[model samples]
Target: MKAFDWQLQKNGYIPMSGQIVDASLVSAPKQRNTEVEKEAIKAGKTGREIWPNEPNKAAQKDMDARWTLKMGGKIRYRSDGTSLPQIALPVFGYKSHIAVDRRFGFIRESALTSAVQADGRMLPRLVTTGNTSSGVWADSAYRSQKNETGLALRMLVSRIHRRKPAGKPMPHNIVRANAAKSAIRAHVEHVFAHQKNRFGLFIRTIGIARAMAKLILANIAYNFDRLVFHQRA
Candidate 1:
């Protein structure tokens, strides 16, 4: 991936239209363990330490991939016209943090983390200094004073979506502004959709290192596919 980024840099393929940053959960096989085992996993106990005698079970255990609640799967509705509440489903896996060039829709930068990691924290790492436009966009999850300050430090403009205050409705103007940002932010979803739908992205591996390796290859494959797409067009 570093080589590919260098290639894009040396060849002037990055058009400076800025980039969009977001992350997708790469679901993995759910591990079934006792409450004590779960607590030990959260407490940073290695699989070997947790299961000293059973080498086979210890090897199969995945301590690096954590669990997180993912909301907004399928929208359910009542028999009437109203929609039901969105349930938060518990997903066990890792996250693929990616920044895609706005002009070409190619994955420019990426990182892998446990599913429990916050999306907001990965913003700085996923951002690329190569995007000459100095403009960035993302969902409200990436919106924070620190991120705003960081962007300012780099002289990058932020089109990140704004968050509504707790117990308060969003103002009409801000709501419209966020909607406009979403229009541009929506392009990043294509990269993810293509990976999930066409590439069938999922993790069957038991450890973070292996799962990340799979994701890295998947990202490279996606770039090759994107290259083919532009060449044909």
Candidate 2:
């Protein structure tokens, strides 16, 4: 994938525009385990260690898959037109993180983790210096003093969206600014939408290593499709 990206640069498909970083959960079959077994898994014990007597059973169990609360699905409403609050649902599987170029919309970098991982921590790993623009865009979840500092250290401009002040109505200026940022940040969503809807991406594997390989292949396929589109244009 790195080689192909480099070749794209040589061929004038460089990611001159800034990059957008985000992650999405790829669903997998939920594991059925007892409380004790779940505790052991949470403690970082291997499947063989937890189920030492049942090698066949251990081989079938996916110890790496995890549970995470997916926030903000469809908004429901009451009969009177009042809207209900968004609910967070538990989703079990892996998380795929990708850095997409704003200009060409190629998946330049990707990482995979258990569904429980934090999206904020993965931001730095996905950013690359190859982009001509230094600006970075992401949702408020990626906003923090640490990330802001990190971006500054890397000489990258921080265009990450900010959250509203807690318990207070969002200031109009911030709401407007985030709205504009959303317009640009939204380009990355197309990549995820295409992969999930078109490639039917899901983790049917056992460990994070296998899951990572699966995500890498999906990203590569997405990039190839993106490249072809650019070529046709």
Candidate 3:
């Protein structure tokens, strides 16, 4: 897969102008356990041993899956000016982190990890070493002093959105900068939407390895379709 993408760039099929980084949580089946079973597992007892009568029951649970909460959408206000309740969705699954070329949205690199993994931590792996002048755009979730410093060290322009501190309004300049960055970074979401809506990219497997393989295949399929579309254009 790496060879094919490298070949595409080498032949000018995929331009390495700049890149965008983002991640999406792919939901997996929720593994349910009783309070006693949960305590047993938390106490370091293997799932199989939780139910001594059923020695083979551990195989039924997806041991690799973990739970994480995704923040809800923006809150809408009522006509009377009251704010709606915001609810966070509980997701049990894994995350697919990706870096895409800015020119045509072709995915350049990808990584899969458990849902508990922070998106910022995967930035180094997702980003490919490319032209120093190229910029990398990402949302506020990827913003941090350490990450910004790392990008500086690599000579990649940090176009990451600035995160507003708690109880403080972001400066006008910072807000405008984020808005501009968002305009370009928004293209990355289209790739994810196409994968999910068009290809049903959700993972139905139980283990991390299987899920990773499925996502990698999905990415490759997306790139092929993107190439065809570019040719038609």
Which candidate gets the maximum lDDT versus the true structure? 2
Clashing pairs in 1: none
Q: All models: lDDT?
A: 0.87, 0.89, 0.82
- Each prediction's Cα RMSD? 3.3, 3.0, 3.3
TM agreement with the true structure for every prediction: 0.92, 0.94, 0.87
Per-candidate count of clashing residue pairs (backbone under 3 Å):
0, 0, 0
Task: Tell me the spans in candidate 3 whose CA falls farther than 4 Å from its real position.
Answer: 39-56, 75-85, 131-133
Better candidate by lDDT, 1 or 2: 2
Write down the lDDT that model 2 would get.
0.89
Pick by lDDT: 2 or 3, better one: 2
Error of 1 at 83 (Å): 13
The ten-residue window of minimal lDDT in model 3 covers: 74-83
**Candidate 2: worst-modelled 10 consecutive residues by lDDT:** 74-83
Query: By TM-score, highest first, what's the ranking?
Result: 2, 1, 3
Question: Residue-wise lDDT of candidate 2 within 1-233, one digit each (tens)?
Answer: 89888888889999968999999999998999999999999999988999999999899899888999998864445655456687888999999899998989998999998888899999899997779999999998899999999999999999999886655566789989998999999999998899999999889988888888888889889989998998998
